[model samples]
Target: MCMKHRKLLTAGIGLLLTVILIALVRLVDAAPIGAQGTSIGLSHLNQFVFDLFGVNMLWYNITDWLGVAAVLTGFVFAVTGLVQLIKRRSLLKVDREILALGGLYIVVIGLYLFFENVIINYRPIIMPDNTSPEASFPSSHTMLVCVIMGSAAMLINRYIRNKPLNRILRAVCYVIIGVTVVGRLIAGVHWFTDILGGILISVTLLSLYEEVISHGK
Candidate 1:
């Protein structure tokens, strides 16, 4: 199959997986097992994982900071795009990959806001300073880290001429993504299903981003 077809197929699979995951979380063993007795989807499995790992505030904070770093990386790209626009005096003259990255970031932010308002399940434990459990489904931190770093890794090769430097940057992005995903899980802030959901959505978004950037090349 052609590359375009493959990209679409991969994106479709990711979306399908995300839909199936959400369905299972809602239908299977869901109960009021979350913090302060909030209802949680996939309560049985979520409870099991939470019990096994327990809560680690240190890991939670670490991953949270890493997520911030990912966002800052995206911010750097946004600034680059803006600088290009000002120098070229035309938005169309700005780097297409950077423009595409900007669009992807907006979508990521939209998803984050959407999930914040729509409660799927609450955190396993109440966060500090919060009187009650907050929405934990899709693990926003995991999603943010994966999408931002994953896309950055993909784009780095296009912009960086130094092969060794490009490799190092890509490696760093992968490491940060790995640490955030695993740390979030180990921190016990989100259910297993939440982590899985975040991963699936990231896959979908990243696939689309790849397709767009490929067309520009």
Candidate 2:
């Protein structure tokens, strides 16, 4: 198959996995297995995993901070684009990669908001300040870290000329994404399905982002 067809196939598969996961969560083994008696899909599996690790606020905090760092990294890119726009006096003058990254971030934010209101599942544990369970489907932290850091890793070589620096940045992004996914899973705040959902959606988004960047080149 051609490159374009291959990319579309990969993205389509990711989206299909995401949809199937959601359906299973809604229709299979669902029970009142979440915090404050909120119903969760795949209750047996989720409860089993929760029992193994229990709650570790430390990991949760660590992953949360890493998610913040990922957002800051995206913010840096946005600022870079803004600086270029201001200096050149035309949005068109900004780097195409940066513009594409901005669009990707916006889509990520939109998905986050959609899941927040749609309420696929509530958190396994109530957060410290919150009185009730929060939306936990697709583990937003995992999704955000994966998308932002994963894309940054993919795009770093194009932005940085220094080989060593580029490698270092890419390695850091990989480590952050890995830690966030694992840490969030063990943090006992989200179901296994939630983490899986996050990963699937990130894969879908990253596939499309890669296609766009590659097409631009």
Question: What TM-score do all the candidates reach, one by one?
Answer: 0.97, 0.96
lDDT score of model 1?
0.90
Q: How many backbone clashes does candidate 2 have?
A: 0
Q: Which stretches of candidate 1 lie over 4 Å from their true place?
A: none
lDDT of 1 at 199: 95
- Over the stretch 1-217, how does candidate 2's per-residue lDDT look in tens digits? 9898788799999999999999999999999989999999999999999999999999999999999999999988889999999999998888888899999999999999999999899999999989999999999999999999999998797888999999999999999999999999999989899999999999999999989888945
What is the lDDT for 68 in model 2? 94
Q: Rate the local accuracy (lDDT) of all candidates.
A: 0.90, 0.93
Segments of candidate 2 deviating more than 4 angstroms: none
